[model samples]
Target: MRLMFLGDVVGRSGRQALVTHLPRLIERFRTDFVVVNGENAAGGFGITEEIAEEFLDAGADCITTGNHVWDQREALVFIAREPRMIRPINFPPGTPGAGATMLTARNGARVFVANVMGRVFMDALDDPVRPLEAALDYHRLGSEVDAAIVDVHCEATSEKQIFGHMLDGRVSLVTGTHTHVPTADHRVLPGGTAFITDAGMCGAFDGVIGMDKEEPGRRYIERTPGQRMTPATGAATVCGVAVDTDDRTGLANWIAPIRVGGDLEPAVPTRWETA
Candidate 1:
């Protein structure tokens, strides 16, 4: 199975880029399944129902989220109905929406998608490692499960890396999100799972994450909120990772970083097959 996991979509720029580029991207890569993190899709804070549908219409099979999942109250209502839209599994039980969903690719392969937020340097949520373990065990029990993708939404790189190691080989792919800065560590783990520290943000690269640079700069320099930070209205970049997994074992065969347009250097996935 060939899957693509996009990083956090920041605001209008991110959404616009996805709508503009994702369709072509999916065709170019021949991706079987696409997952995008939409936590920051609504004005750089939370995602809205409209934007979620836009992402799905643009070729995303599933949308994942992080701490910003609750920023939009409407999400609470829509999440219940949209099974492909997932929040952090580590949230308090009964939080809302399904944390993991089984999505079928166009080719009829069952793909298990999970979203988990890290406890370190973030919030007082449940242990991320535990939820990940449980999700893997639950899906691996059935032969119907073909691939598993885990979105480790987090703040600390070290924490994400640690969890990646813990889940190495157990899941098909483990990609990080929230930082909005794509790391250069895309690689197939020794255990065969594809991993990346962070998939980066799908917004302008010339600003503070995805927000306008002026407000954030002012807040940092003056230690006061002079104005509300808004999403930078500029050419945006779609950043993330692409992984190819073996059908029989559900392990990664190759992994590559994905960065298209904007200030960041361009990156494309190569056609490589492992023996």
Candidate 2:
């Protein structure tokens, strides 16, 4: 299976860029499944039902979210109805949305996708390991599911790496989100899982983590909060990772980072392009 995971979509700029180019990306990569992190799609705060639908229309099979999963007031209602859109799994028992789901991919394969938040410097939640492991046990790849992926929505690189190593042989990919900046280290782990510290954001690279520099900068230097942070309006570089899984084992056979347009360097996943 050819799977792709896009990092967080910051706001209008990110959403527009993704909606505009996602179909082309799906065609160019021959992707079988696509997962997008949309926690920040709504004005750089939270995702809305309309925006989640927009992502599905653009070719994403499932949409994952992070710490800001409930940033928008409407999300609390719509997420309960949308099975394709999921929040962190470790949320208390009654959280509106699910943290994991088994969605059918474009190729008619059962794909297990889980969204989990890291407690390191973030909101406190249930310890992710036990629940995540139990979920994986039930959805065992190569038997019950064709492919598996976990979106480690987190702050520290250490926590992200720990998650990756902890679930190394169980899933096809373990990708990180929330830090916004793209990391250079992307590789297929020894256990055949694809991992990256941060898959980065699908928003503008010019600002601080896809936000306008003015406000974040002011707060740091002035030691006082000013205007609310907003998404940068510049052209966005769609940042993400691409993975090709083995048919039998459902483990990653190849992996690569993708960056296109805006301020960052453009990467075309030439391996697949030329394969």
Candidate 3:
């Protein structure tokens, strides 16, 4: 099974990049399933139902969110009705959206995708580990599910790493989001899970984490709120990772980082070139 996981999408630029490049990516990578984080798709805040649907239409099988999941007020209601869109698993029990779901890939493989938020230097939420364990218990990779992917959206890299290690052999992939910066540590773990501290944001690289530079710069330098932060409108680079898993074991056999367009150095998995 081949799976691709995209990081947080920031505003219009990110959405445009995704809409424009996703089809080509799916074809080039021979992807069977795709998961994307749409937490910051709405003008650098939370995702709206419309945008979430747009992402799903553009080739994402599932859309996951983080702390900003509720930044847009309408999400509180629409998320409950949209099973493809999920909020953090650690959110309060009565939260509107689901935390995990089982989806069938293009190749008829059953894939389980789960979203969880960390509690380090961020909002205090229920323990993410337990929820993840429960999800894995219900959907065992190679048995009940062909592949399992987990998105650990959080502010700290250490926390994300820990979570990834905890679910090592139990899941197919464990990647992070929310930081909007891609980390270079993309590698298959000892337990066969593909891990990356962050898959990075899909938006302009010229600004501060996909936000327009001016507003964030002023607030940091002047130490006072200047104006509302808006998404940068420049060309964007879609950042993400692709994992190829063993059909029998549902464990990652190959892992590669993907960065295309905009300011970042472009990369596509070498395996795709040969394919």
Give all candidates' CA lDDT scores.
0.88, 0.92, 0.93
Q: How much is the lDDT of residue 263 in candidate 1? A: 81
lDDT of 2 at 147: 98
Off by over 4 Å in 3: none
| lDDT for model 2 | 0.92
For residues 42-154, could you state the per-residue lDDT of candidate 3 as single tens digits? 99999988999899999999999999999999999999898888998888788888999999999999999999999899989999888878888999999999999999998
Model 2 lDDT per residue over 1-275, tens place: 89999999999999999998789999988999999999999999999899999999999999999889888989999999999999999998888978899999888999999999999999899988878888998999999999999999999999999999988889999999999998989998999899999999999878889999889999999999678899999899899999999989999998899897788888867788777
After superposing candidate 1 on the true structure, give the runs of residues whose Cα lies further than 4 Å from its correct spot. 272-275
TM-scores of the candidates are 0.96, 0.98, 0.98
Order the candidates by lDDT, highest first — what do you get?
3, 2, 1
Q: Model 2: C-alpha RMSD to truth?
A: 0.8
Native-structure RMSD, model 1: 1.8
Which portions of model 2 show Cα errors greater than 4 Å? none
Listing every candidate in turn, what is its Cα RMSD in Å to the true structure after a full C-alpha superposition? 1.8, 0.8, 0.9
